[model samples]
Target: MLEVYIDGATLGENGKSAASFVAKNKQVCLEGYTFIGEKTNHEAEFHALYFALVTLKHDYSDEILSIRSDSKIVVDTIEKAYTKNPAFLSYYNKIAELITHFPHVFIKWISDKDNKRADTLARTGLQTESTVIQSCS
Candidate 1:
């Protein structure tokens, strides 16, 4: 089974957002963090999960997966496979589609303390955005 930890960071509501994930098992370890432009925190959270699933599905399609995130809103929405909010429903729908490629996916809600690595990576994405801007000037 592959254990995936994910996190999303936003500078402010409807502000710059970052998404990150770490996926690992005995055979492999993979991770990614990126600035995803302007989005809400919840949107960023979903993006991280979706980004991770897309990254894993091709290579680890046969493996059972555990998706871990610190956002209750994101985790709850995914677990139910439904959301009343039109904004969130879009993300849930996209994530649900990607899920069909896997054998099984278990989503877990974790504490921010436990998801430090992914959180750090997500914040780094904010710094990366800052760095890119500084270098361009």
Candidate 2:
């Protein structure tokens, strides 16, 4: 069983956007970042999920996964409690596509405070063009 925590950050005016992931036992991180040129916070959030899932797919072939994030919309959409907005359906669908590969997938929501490491990493990724990625490979 593996647990993952992820988060994304988007600054003002294509300033910076990043996705950061932390796996169980505080072992390494899987992180990514890009200059959005111009995008919204919501888009960054989706990017976070996208990159996180992709990382999981490449890193773990046949393992059940549990993903945690601080994004309520992401959690709710995955849980089917809230309807996916038409504007975001495409991105959501993309996310859903990758999720199908997992034997079991769980998305959980936690407070921002509890997710500080991932959040900070996301912000750091955005600030630095280096695109920091740490993971126990």
Candidate 3:
């Protein structure tokens, strides 16, 4: 089984942004990243999931996939408990489309304290354009 946790950060409009994914198996960890430029925080959040899903596409399947995010909008929207504004429907759809490729997935909301690794990577991405967040194993 593979357990993956993802997080994203946005510095400001037109500012640096990044998404980080940490995949853990027992004592091992694998991380991934992408530098997102000039996007909102919400966009960054969704991008984090997108990057993780794409990176794991080759290895993801019926196995349990768990995701954690600080964005209530993304979490609630994905759970179908709330309807997002029509203006952002495209964003929602993009995430939904990516989800179709996963057999079993779980998303949860975690406070900033529990999501430090991702936060660090996000901040790091904002500070350096050439730096790529490393995947920990």
Candidate 4:
């Protein structure tokens, strides 16, 4: 099983958003953050998961994936099969699509204390001057 933890941080003063993720027990895995330009905190949360999923799908297509996120909004929305905000529909749909590629995918909400690594990576991503245009894995 592939275990992934994801998080997103937004610099409210500059309107910059960044996302990060960590894959546990993978020798060569995508575990970093990238500047995603301007986005709301909610959007960034979705982006974090989206980027991680895209990075893992091609290589771990048949593997069981367990994704954890600190954002309750993202986790609840995905798990409940509904979104209250129309602005997030595209992101929501994209996540749903990517989930289909995995033989088994489980998304769960975790406490911030448990997601420290990803949270730190996300904050560090906001401090970087450059944006990553491609997958770093």
Candidate 5:
């Protein structure tokens, strides 16, 4: 099984929003974060989930995957199979599409204390000097 942790953060303004993910297995660990122009904290959280799904889908297509996030909206929206907010519909749809490509995917809600690594990476992503998005894994 492959395990992934994701989180997002916003600094002061629209430009500071960022998303991050850490994916790991017994053999290797891959983690990264990227600046996401202007977006709300919820949108940034979705972006983090999106990045992790996209990054792992190709390589773990046939494996069971588990993803953890500190955002309740992101986790509950997926786990409950509904979203009342129109602003989140697009992200919900994209996540649904991505899940189809994998054999199995689980989205779980986790405490902030348990998600420190992704949170730190997301904050670090905001400190980048470049306006252009940057990512490292």
Candidate 6:
């Protein structure tokens, strides 16, 4: 089974956000982070989940997935497998599609304190974006 940790963060007045995910097994660890331009905290969280699943799909599709997130909104909605909000539903739909690739998937909500690595990666992404923007000015 692969354990995945995902997190998202937003920075600046424009809400430039970033998504980060880490997938690791006993012998390997992979990390991914991307600045996803402007987005709400919720949107960024979904994007993090998306990227995490995509990462696992590429190399661990057949393995059991133990996904973890600090966002209650993301974890709860995914557990229910439904959402009424249009924006959230959009992500939910995409996530539903992604789940088809994994034979076994389990998601659990965790505290922010427990998800430090992913959280830091997400903030790093935002900081990197800010650096680029600042350098351009």
Of models 4 and 6, which has the larger TM-score?
A: 6
Candidate 6 lDDT score relative to the true structure:
0.85
In model 1, pairs of residues that clash are none
lDDT (Cα, tens digit) per residue for candidate 5, span 1-137 = 77889998886545568888887778657787888878889999998988878877777678677999999999999999789999889998998999999888898999999999899888887887222223334
Better of 3 and 5 by lDDT: 5
Off by over 4 Å in 2: 13-15, 25-37, 81-83
Report the lDDT tens digits of candidate 2 across residue range 2-110: 6778787877745456677776634443444443334567767767777777777876746677888899887888788345477568778888888887888888999
Give model 2's TM-score versus the native structure. Answer: 0.82
Q: Write the per-residue lDDT of candidate 6 for residues 54-93, one digit (tens) a residue.
A: 7678777888889999999999999999888898898999
Q: Candidates' TM-scores? A: 0.91, 0.82, 0.82, 0.89, 0.89, 0.90
Per-residue lDDT tens digits of candidate 1, residues 8-92?
Answer: 8999789999888888888777888888899999999998998888878888899999999999999899888789998888789
- Per-residue lDDT value at 129 in model 5: 22
User: If both were scored by TM-score, which would come out higher, candidate 1 or candidate 4?
Assistant: 1
Find the candidate with the highest lDDT and give its number: 1
Error of 5 at 27 (Å): 1.7
For 1-137, candidate 4 gives per-residue lDDT tens digits of 88899998997844899988887655545576888999999888999999888878888788888999999999899899799798788999999999999988889999999999889888888999344423335
RMSD of 4: 2.7
Candidate 1: C-alpha RMSD after superposition: 5.3
Ranking by lDDT: 1, 6, 4, 5, 3, 2
TM-score-best of 2 and 5: 5
Residue pairs that clash (backbone atoms under 3 angstroms), model 2: 29-134, 29-135
Judging by lDDT, tell me the better candidate of 1 and 4: 1
The alpha-carbon RMSD values of the candidates against the true structure, listed in the order shown, are 5.3, 2.8, 2.5, 2.7, 2.8, 5.6
RMSD of 2: 2.8
Residue 29, model 2: Cα distance from true site in angstroms: 6.2
- Cα error, candidate 2, residue 93 (Å): 0.9
lDDT of 3 by residue, 41-126 (tens): 87778777778777777665545678888777777877883465774476667767777777877888888888888777767766
lDDT (CA) for every model shown?
0.85, 0.71, 0.72, 0.84, 0.83, 0.85
